[model samples]
Target chain A: MKVQSVAVLWQIWSRKSFVTSSTLRAFSTSLINPSNSILMSPSLVSLDCPDTWTSGSVQSDRSSVQKYTSKHVAQILDGKVMAEEIRSGIALEVKRMKESIGQVPGLAVILVGQQRDSLTYVRNKKIGSEEVGIKFLMTMLPDNCTENEVCKALQSYSENPSVHGIILQLPLPRHLDEGKILGLLTLDKDVDGFHPVNIGNLAMLGREPLFIPCTPKGCIELLLRSGIDIKGKKAVVIGRSNIVGLPMSLLLQRHHATVTIIHAYTKNPDKVAHEADILITAAGVPNLVCRNWLKPGAIVVDVGTTPVEDPECEHGYRLIGDVCFEEASKVASAVTPVPGGVGPMTVAMLLHNTLESAKRAFKFS
Target chain B: MKVQSVAVLWQIWSRKSFVTSSTLRAFSTSLINPSNSILMSPSLVSLDCPDTWTSGSVQSDRSSVQKYTSKHVAQILDGKVMAEEIRSGIALEVKRMKESIGQVPGLAVILVGQQRDSLTYVRNKKIGSEEVGIKFLMTMLPDNCTENEVCKALQSYSENPSVHGIILQLPLPRHLDEGKILGLLTLDKDVDGFHPVNIGNLAMLGREPLFIPCTPKGCIELLLRSGIDIKGKKAVVIGRSNIVGLPMSLLLQRHHATVTIIHAYTKNPDKVAHEADILITAAGVPNLVCRNWLKPGAIVVDVGTTPVEDPECEHGYRLIGDVCFEEASKVASAVTPVPGGVGPMTVAMLLHNTLESAKRAFKFS
Candidate 1:
């Protein structure tokens, strides 16, 4: 059987056709025995195929029917491509706003302590914001910066006429209280959407947050732009953290999907996971979800990016997502790759949120 | 089969023994056919049974064995009793505060427009507050009051030195945006916990809201006071309203329960409800959940108080909860009765929150 368009793939995924039932039964068996759940080899599901997509344990999307020696693979939910598309649109908007308002949107980031990951995130945010013509400002404080200093920094950014959005990078020194510092950001300037008020609005049905957390917003954007309908679908989110998991689940629910959160205390996580039509994993545990944990033709979003030590790689470490991509590719109809997946989208979304905050602040609309 | 002692009943609820496995299988059949879910003759699962305390459902407490009935029943999670107990403690604290500080805790309520239910609630709140020696100050506005008028009233209450807690009654006139007026309430004076900041705090894991929404807080109080272990339990909240369902689900999740919310758009809600170990319904749909919708021995908290027209009842209407009480009693291990259940606890919780706000404001221990 050859499948060409995503619409067809969605049909197969939603219908759970006879062709995929055997593969599903096998995957179901793995759920019953979680120890054997992981598939040894990872397969990259490429949507860049116009070929015979035959049903088999080891399938490929190569154009030649004769090359179909393997099982059915997943279609890649290319976040990089989507992020680039969004960034382009945001850039156009930024240009329009600059022309009308005589100033570009500005985003301020306050980073305390020198954590490698935090530095990388701030750098990416800066690059992404500049790419979209947003004025990027960074406030770096010493490792031993007092709580008053951090609060003062936030207060300055919040009051700055040019700064439309403010973000305080996470994982401050152990002694510093993140909540107290985050609370210091004015709700209007809280571009990261980490403030309780912003999050609270997101959780409420009738209310809308000025900004949604970048990563989750990016995940939902990918799904929406891909023509995936969230309403009435069983969307299972793995993890319950405020940043990604909790808000993502709430967003999906707001879109009319039935959401179930599988957390640390959840019993029979694998079995519960198999029931989801759309599965999103944000639990930073690398390779925690195996191929069998997903229902056949399920759409998977891997938000986890945990760096595991690997001397063979240039960085001496490789970032792995929560899901085992290879095995998952064979089972899930669509899946996101770690580095190119949620990572780029998250940065793009941060700029998008900043732009939005700027538009509201300047009344550019 | 007569069983004595709540310990024996708890064992039956938790163990899923041979007797209940068969019972569960029979009830599980109702999922495929919701029309047949409600049993014709509902049996109340009572704890008032007599017999030597046995391991089975029929075993009764030795002291109460003589009062045992043939049919299995649920133990009532009496909210009235619990709320009264909480109020007594709060009252003592109020009296102590009056003695020490020469003034009792003060709660100011601002009510706009005259809705019958809203007036009733306000009156009840005043009586409850005064009964506990709390200074009750209420600001009543006309039905045609402007949004500014409402905000000005809230401002007055916020500025009142004696008023430690301020509540703006909800469902203001349709012309007025409740969000705008609600935003005016100071976070410290937001005793209702409807402020975005407070709700946001509640949604966060490490941070606690200054005040939890009265209704949901009361529900959690009932569960905790009843000794029901919330950890690792499968909790299903039926509704996503900001007031009750949303916060209740968050509270349950915070307690380490794997939580799922079933809303109006949810497909196969009955199937989802059947999976819950603890079910909380805030759907406001009268008799929406039937006996078959529950897993045998599950605990239920019904937050709905819909006034349905009933000619047989005085006032030409009767209050009904989301759960079909008579039907639910047969399946649930324990269930709160509608009238005396979450209703009274809600009021008590409002005062409890007010007391807490006062304690914080006055530096009372």
Candidate 2:
């Protein structure tokens, strides 16, 4: 598992880089004015000629800067609303297939161990599949199961012919080798699309993945449904993890958007974040994206899922994403909330992916 | 074939393009001193904003001006020299394999048409295979051969125990379904590395390919040999063809470099090109990367193969790469010559790939 060297990987990211953070912040503040002789690009990013690279000295030219207006309201990309719409689209397709060919899609779910979060996720996935009228198979393996036992369970489902799509619930018990198990699954049945081969395909230009991971797909669906122009947009993905942020950058670039990935170790993450036409944050940090860390009228998609204790709520804990939603709504155009933004759409897409997998596998109507 | 729409593609590129020759020339002049005072990242680029999004300008204060020094000449990266070293390395390995295994690696080349360049390439490939002591098999089918014929030829070689590597020579009798036939070749034996799946793996971050297409591999090998630091460098590939430029960008990025790709109809190709620490030109346009366009000390890898009249050579026409070699060499700290640069490395890598395929398939030392 990559986790064995996880400490080394984390250490690589923990060091304070050579560039000064305060210098970067000051540069960002200066770029805020609309008409003070705009230095088109900062030298910080220029890699052409270090000898010729000059520092911008303060000139006494303070031209007029545009003032912000309060009329702007956040265009909530309510994922719950969009997810329901997509579910109906899938349901209609499923119904059509059943009527014409009597073929129904089937998805097999493998969950190892009894982690509370994993149980809840597996349950939600099962419910979502049912709602879409796809046949679902669930296998619960004990925490201490051997690799052979897990392999046997996977082999049966893979050879079952009835099982079209397969998903192994993530963050398996501590003893398991995650990468090996994920790689072992058949490419055709890998609904999560975490297979390195599939990911490798996604990174290439002109090659499309059989299935893109759900969150990135969900983000695309949200953008396209909202009629947003993705082409050549200055998009910043505020994380570098494989599942959400990296794939999101590739997908956005494929749609022709110019993308930059800023992560925790980035020297000036906030300054970089502010330059985005579209900002998608999945850093799992609370309030990492402040209102000031945004360009006016930019679209924001926050994918973080952190829980905060709230005594007033009956559940005692409330869900929140990485963005400061209240502040973002005041300054920027549109935003997706923590609980309803990307969360609901992820499950809805899983069902969508299952139906797709079955139809492709069976040559159904 | 993509050729059907290529004319329209060219028309689209030639017209409605904001990429003026004058602007390209300005970028050439600005290569000397990067003036951060004036630039607009292509106007057609999106903001993902609503109709009510107001236009704003950014002020450039001197205090805000950053010291921009391009870390251009980290070291010299000579592709031609490195290619010779790699070829010799492969020769030693092949000799050892022949002695121990009692069989040499064999590569089957299937050519379906008589495209002048394709024939020339096939002849050279055979020569290269012989030089490396890898057995070369060439099957020249007629231009009128059906798609099934090509597939059958590939399948026969795939089944042959002696055929360690296979390639369906490209520009493949244009009428044949190139995609389907190429897909049929076993991924393990795909020496051309053009199979979309193999190309995908090459472009992925953590994924590794059994065979990386020769040109990009040569480019990286050159940089590594020259002691150039690629990590965290900003690289821009000037063309988006699947063969070289697009994959080149992805490979650089996967190595932790920030990469940008420009293609036909790209609004500002020159602006993007200036950002590269390692510049690779495969556009086939003669003299594409000129003296004015080069950032001093940039490592240039030339992969263009345009035949231009040169009575000085016995062939009556001389071979030239995408780069204006003479001018680029003067401005660039190091540059690869047209004939001697990337060409030899490509053939060498093919030999290396066949050996790699044999090693993995037979588990040889």
Candidate 3:
């Protein structure tokens, strides 16, 4: 058997002091226990081969000639590459729709505050929409904007004939009522899928929601595209946030996966997590999931993207996932990396939802 | 330690063949492992003492002089008694409101198709309402009634000032669109809490629903009244029907329990069920949950009520719970029985929700 040794180092930065520490880890590509490889299906292996042991290390020179053998190394579920492929396919469909009917999908966003992360998210969404040939529009409001102002903006987008999908960027000012504001968005144009009706439909059996929340949808897409069978699988989702964790569990259950949700108040979380065949962590706590939290040969999807300040990085901060990537590779059969994994897929799913809304509105199938 | 042995025989009747086989089992009242008693809080023990080893056997003579002893005998979570206490409280409040304000809470039901089970449920609701001083009204329609007739009935109740709450009996005729008809119900009058908006609110965090579904609410009431702590507990809910299981799981999560939902496609369900500190079975399959499926000292809430035909019974049938009561009594710390357990609690909760709706309508604090 041909063995490949990959040495990777991750710099852990403390949130308070900005102090960093690095640790080196290596795993082999060889399958140590063939019987333990539950997700090593032919279709998964084909997509897994290209980015199998790619490291998210900031320094490229960390890879060395030293050979370190381990039982198994996880196949990387590369959302960046998958997202690009989906975007390209969507772009072609958008072009064809434009040529045939002279109409393109339009997505409008209501950005409440000028939070740095929210701005970056809105920019990425705009770029992703443009990449797919979808028209993008935004209504910018100040942090001190009243509820009426936000409602007016939502009403405008809702009534606009060209606008197919509308989203209100979250984490509004403390003065504003988030639930009341979100409830005002028209159900037809709610591409973000935060509306109560959409959530209810998603949770219920024999009912379909107009849209599924983007981040969870992206995670499921990554799994399906990689040919992982969700039916009859034991799935554990950490965190129960409405945006990601709650909908993610509901979606997994819809796919016939027995799902357990672990929240902050949950006791013995690791014990619960270790029983999962498929584990999705969106707790937003850096390095919350360790090697012991995962079952051997379990597929892991990390949705957490906590920002830690790092002086060595160009962006002044590094994105850390809930799972310890260096540790997870040795235990998990497959894992998704932060920054390049669920993040890119969330943007891609948003574009997909927007396109779907437009198609539904136009009765274009 | 003083130990008490109780021999109980349950006649298991198969649905296809009503051939009954009686099995005699016995359990001790003594605490076998003191350290394993997680729910042995003082408040819980008090409620556990009364009706601790009561049996639901149809034959009274089966409680014989068999001295077979086991680790424990589960405390009966008597919903019938608890529901009566709640109804008395509601009755007092209703009497006060009627005397002082010259108004009383009114609940209207639209019953389409005289399905035997539905008719029995509706009749029980009416009797329960009258007992609690709540005005009850019903609209009867034929089995082949049109959707428009149902819609008209719903509209009349929705517009009526006297009717504070309206419930359209579930399992409507085959031809009528359930979702569409449910959508027509006024949000304020959705006392049954089947509306998508209410369900969505229940599923979401930091949002309150107008009404919670009766059965699940009743189950939680049972736990709380028994002084069982739900927070930080491992809960497993079997079956995911929109009515009982889904909302039950969601409600458990709201109380901060680490919840796992097991549906038909779930693999190794007993393994998952064995880990729960709180196990609620709503699978509707008689005796689906066995002794091995439960964790030691786990509180079992059996929501299943599958009616089995019997020639000896007064009603020509007997209701069987999801858990095998004889087996569960030996392993579980506490368990709810069918027919007299969650059944009466459902009616109590329905009246509670109706009174609340009236209170909100009248702006009475």
TM-score of chain B of each: 0.80, 0.77, 0.81
Ranking by TM-score: 3, 1, 2
Residue-by-residue lDDT tens digits, candidate 2, B203-273: 54445666777667667766665666665555666665566765676566555555655544333355556
Pick the winner on lDDT between candidates 1 and 2. Answer: 1
Question: lDDT of model 3 at residue A354?
Answer: 87
Which wins on TM-score, candidate 1 or candidate 3? Answer: 3
Number of residue pairs clashing in candidate 1, backbone atoms closer than 3 angstroms, sequence gap of 3 or more or interchain:
26
Cα displacement (angstroms), candidate 2, residue B318, comes to 3.7
* Model 1 agreement with the true structure over B79-185: per-residue lDDT tens digits: 76666556656676787788988877899988888876677667777777877788999999999989888888888888888998998877778999987778788
lDDT (tens digit, per residue) of candidate 3 on B1-365: 00000000011211122111211000111134333211121221122111111112111212222232586688999876666556656676677678878889999999999877677667767777877689999999999999999999999999999999998987788999998899899999998887878888888877778888878888898898888998778899987878888888988888778899977766667778888889998876678788889888889998877777888976577777778999989888899987667776777778888988998888864
In model 3, residue pairs whose N, Cα or C atoms come closer than 3 Å (at least 3 residues apart or on different chains), thus clashing, are none
In model 3 chain A, the worst 10-residue window by lDDT is: A1-10
What tens digits encode model 1's per-residue C-alpha lDDT throughout A160-186? 989998988777898898877787789
Q: How many residue pairs clash (N, CA or C atoms closer than 3 angstroms) in each of the candidate models, in the order given? A: 26, 17, 0
Question: After aligning candidate 1 to the native by TM-score, how far in Å is the CA of B19 from where it should be?
Answer: 43
TM-score of 1: 0.80
Residue A361's lDDT in candidate 2? 81
